[model samples]
Target: DASRIAIRHGLPNSAALPIAQHKDYDRMFADIRDKLHAKSGDPVKPEHLE
Candidate 1:
């Protein structure tokens, strides 16, 4: 289920590892969404971390 969700959102399969190990699904999904919208090669801003 975790892997499926990750792949659906265009995240690497490995991204589901921490979710399985630590169960931090909320953070993982939020981080993935942030990264998806971010431009490649651009640095993450402080607000992005929030």
Candidate 2:
């Protein structure tokens, strides 16, 4: 999960997904954040992001 976030943020790819880069990492995170927010809890913000 942690690596996914980074890979999806142009930070670094994990040993899980075969992502070579975070082309649309920000957008990916946005979509996920929206979906999660719609369900419950607050949207995932990068302020306190690791």
Question: Which is the leading candidate under TM-score?
Answer: 2
Query: Given candidate 2, what's the lDDT at residue 41?
Result: 53
Candidate 1: list runs displaced more than 4 Å: 1-23, 38-50
For every candidate in turn, the CA RMSD to the true structure comes to 10.0, 10.9
Screening candidate 2 with a backbone cut-off below 3 angstroms (N, C-alpha, C), the clashing residue pairs are none
Structural RMSD, model 2: 10.9
Alpha-carbon deviation at 48 in model 1, angstroms? 19
TM-score of 1: 0.28
lDDT string for model 2 (12-45, tens) is 5555455535568757766777755643356566
What TM-score would each prediction reach against the true structure?
A: 0.28, 0.30
Residue pairs clashing, model 1: none
